[model samples]
Target chain A: MSDKHMSSQFDADLNLVSSKVLEMGGLVEAQITRAMHALNDFDIEIADQVIAAEETLNTMEITIDEECSNIIARRQPAARDLRLLLAISKTITNLERAGDEADKIAKRVKRLAEDGSSRTVNIAEIKLSGEMAATILRRALDAFARLDTVAAAQIVRDDKAIDEEFRAFVRKLVTYMMEDPRTISAGLEYLFIAKAIERIGDHAKNIAEFIIYIVKGTDVRHKSRDALEREALS
Target chain B: MSDKHMSSQFDADLNLVSSKVLEMGGLVEAQITRAMHALNDFDIEIADQVIAAEETLNTMEITIDEECSNIIARRQPAARDLRLLLAISKTITNLERAGDEADKIAKRVKRLAEDGSSRTVNIAEIKLSGEMAATILRRALDAFARLDTVAAAQIVRDDKAIDEEFRAFVRKLVTYMMEDPRTISAGLEYLFIAKAIERIGDHAKNIAEFIIYIVKGTDVRHKSRDALEREALS
Candidate 1:
């Protein structure tokens, strides 16, 4: 094949792999959204569906990783292409882990459903926080697809707000538990769900970091938000 | 340079990178061990130390990742060497996350220390489980260093035991919190600590999976424990 033909073929392969990563990201987003809804409404069916879909997420992770490995071996892609491949492989793991966090939330909901507790604790704050977490994740994935470092950096900054919301929700739950020990079980479940959402936010931040790295070849992980934003702009 | 010398240089570089990964693993193990001790004794100093060491762990992770990228670019390592680089990079991330879990445990300890609650709950189970988690992590890293798939598989199996212990601990803590709402704050802290230890075990399992992939060239993640055991035995 001619050089131009080979380059175009490689681009096609890269595009295919990128599309698969996006597909996996979409599924993970659904898992988070469904799991949160399950918690909010005490829907066992949605929770069970999230649990069932975990296997599919796991399969997607393995397939994407294998495809990355194959491309690396076959193409020996250099510099930017290589960095993107590395980022994609790492991003999938984070996405699958975010799915695992969602699955954890679903499992808690499943237990709550089995208990059949009629005591409706106020989860409004949790609901709002969960939405924020999901939005951050969706926006992070969007930044990744577009390689938008500015947007990625902004999402990384957004994680702090989610974390603050999580802490506030936990404090409120603690007060509620103190007021009525009867709510402890359900309250504990909500705490875990809140934590799961916080972790999802962290995974989204990780994806954002990957985007920054891919775009600028800078390792922005573990850096302060201030520094990251400056670097993203630079 | 001759082919022999070039091959030797590549081997040296790989060894250096692998050793760095092991070093990072050692720091993570220390973090877990110290965090557990701090939780058991309410040693604020040890907790502070763990918190302080987190920066070093983060730095190590970034350095090791960069080294892996450099090796891939310079050596263009193929097949087994390539797989090892990928696994090392991933394993370091898991180790760093496990370190983060330890840091979370330490931060909780810091809060508990300030609260000055004189009530001593039965944390023996949690301590044992934490030790088990640390042991599994150490073994997983050793397996990676030696490429021992059998040891990795055993570590993977061992994670279930930690999960069982975590669940039992949480149930007991929940009972304590319900029996005496006064213990709710500390009890919740213990719950978070237990969850962190459980997550550390998960990171160990992830490392074990990487080791298995490095050895057997098969993705064992998302499979049933029974299936994983069968594959191990096979």
Candidate 2:
């Protein structure tokens, strides 16, 4: 192939790579949302679906990573392409971590379903978690697709809300456990679910960081995502 | 100057640069440890000390970055020296993030000193956090001083410990607030402090990743740090 043809081919491959990453991001985002939904309603079937989805998300990450490495090695991309590859690489890490958190939630749901906690914890506790997970997952995916650093940075505050929800969930669970000794095992496992959901929020923030890095070539991990969001939105 | 004389002079400058980075790492390590203590006791004075130390850490990071940049411009090092410069560059990023986490913890401490909780919520909480921070801090500094990937990889377990502590602390704080509405504000702030410390542990992990990169010339952030530890150590 001519040089121009080869350049177009590489660009096409890079585009393919980006779409795959975003696709993986979408899968992870959906997996967490489904897992959250499953946890809230004790829908073992939905939870199982999320569990099965984990393998897909994991494989997509590996695929996208391989593609990125191939492009870097063969195409020797510079500047923006380099940023894109690096961001995608980091996004894989974030997405994989998110998938892990989703799996944990799914496993917690399975245990909770088996343990039969219908009469123990209130639905309000679980719903809050599901809602927060859904919101963050959507924002994380949105940021990735748009390469929207500002939107991604602002998504960090969503974590604060998720943290609040987890905080409230744990409090309610612990109180129920303390009040009724019968609720202890269920409550401990329930708190684990809440922790997993919180982790999903963290990984979502990690996704947002990938978006920021891709768009702005800046890494804002461990920075105040709230501050980053404010700056981006402004 | 002759080639040999110029090379020695360059080495002298590079030594100064490295020494500053190590010095900065020492300060960052101490700040992390001290922040944990301040959080444990709500020691305003210790928090103040940490706050004061931030300037030194910032200066260290900036000076090292500049020196590295200057060395690259002037000497254009390769192989071992190149690795060292790269390590120094990445280490500066991690150390800066570490300092930020420490600063956050210190700020949380100051708030805790004034309006936050002085009564210990749970001893397990403090013990777990202190141990995690102390372990990661030690390993990261060891990685830099000895260029030991084995030592650096050890920070991964400590990071896991930090994550566990953080999750548990959030649960405990939530439990505390749930038991009584009065504990809400205090529990929330302490939650943020726990979060900051958890982030400090993450920065340490990032440093460990950089160490792996330097030692092996491969980016291994997403790999399991435990197996890496075994490989690097043996």
Candidate 3:
């Protein structure tokens, strides 16, 4: 193949991989929302849907991983191309973990629903935080798709809000458990769900870091959000 | 340099990076043990040590990551060499998160110690699970170091025991909280610690999967332990 043709072929392969990642991201984003809704409305159908979708998420991860490995083995891509493949592989893992978190939430919600305790507590804050997590997740995927490090940094900043919401839910649930021993079972369930949402936010932040890394070739992980922002923008 | 000399140079660099990862793994193993000890003995000093060591863990991760990136950029390693770099990069992230989980456990232990709640429960089972998690972690790193797929598969099997232990702790804690509302605060603390330990086991399992991927070039994650055992043996 001519050099130009080979470069275009690599681009086409890269685009195919990027689109697969986006598809997985979209599925995961929907999974979070549906999980939250299932918890909020005691909808077992949505809960089961999320559970069923977990397999698809796993398959997508494996496919994308294989594609990345194939690209590296065949193209021997260097520098920026190599970095992009690395970022995609890492981000997909995070996205799949986020999907797992969503599955956890859905499973717990299913149990709560079955036990008839799903609506026992005021889950308004939990629902709100779940929405925020999903939103940040979608935005992170967007930032990744666009290679927009600044927007990725913004998603990192947004995770703090979801974390605060998680803490607030924890405090509220703890208070409820303390006030009434009878509520302890339901409270613990809520605690796990809230914690899952918090983890989803962390996964989103991880994906955001991969975005910045792909764009700037810097490992922004383990850094403060402020540091990430400054580094990504500068 | 001759091709022979260049190949040896790459091998030396690879060995150096592997040793660094093993060093980080050892520290993380000790962190898990000490965190459990702090929780068991209510040892604030040990808890503080684990908390302080988290920064070093982060630094080691960054160092290993930089080494892999430099090797990739300079050598443009292909096929197995490239796969090794990819696996090392991913495994270090898992190790760093495992370190984070240990730090979380230690922090919770410190708080519980301050409240004089660490001794409220027997905690023998929790300590046992922590030991199992650390053992599996050490073995996973060893597998990666030696490219032992069977040992990695065995670590995956071992994690099941830790998960069962975690569930047992959860059941016991829930009963305690239900029987006495006053124990809710301390119970929640233990819950978080047990959850952290369980998550540490998960990170170990993740590392094991990476080792398998590096050895066999197959993604064995999200599969049953039985399937992984079969694949690793095959």
lDDT tens digits, residues B16-126, model 1? 998889899999999999998888778999999999999999999999999898888888876778888888889989999999999999999888887997245788778
Evaluated on CA atoms against the true complex, candidate 2 attains a DockQ of 0.10
Tell me which of candidates 2 and 3 scores higher on DockQ.
3
Query: What ranges in model 3 sit over 4 Å off?
Result: A1-6, B1-6
lDDT, residue B187, candidate 3: 86
Sort by lDDT, best first.
1, 3, 2
Predicted candidate 3 versus true structure: per-residue lDDT over B1-234, tens digit per residue: 012335787889888998898999999999998888888778899999999999999999988988987888788776677778888898999999999999999999889888875566657778889899988998998888788989999898889999999989888887888887778888888889889999999999999998888777778999888888888988
Chain A superposition TM-score, candidate 3: 0.96
Each candidate's number of clashing pairs is: 0, 1, 0
State the iRMSD of every prediction, in order shown.
0.9, 7.6, 1.6
Which pairs in model 3 have colliding backbones? none
Candidate 2 interface RMSD value: 7.6
Clashing pairs in 2: A154-A229
Q: Name the lDDT value of residue B161 in candidate 3.
A: 97
lDDT: worst 10-residue window of model 2 chain A: A1-10
State the lDDT at B163 in candidate 2: 88
Point out the higher-scoring one by DockQ: 1 or 3.
Answer: 1
In model 1, residue pairs whose N, Cα or C atoms come closer than 3 Å (at least 3 residues apart or on different chains), thus clashing, are: none
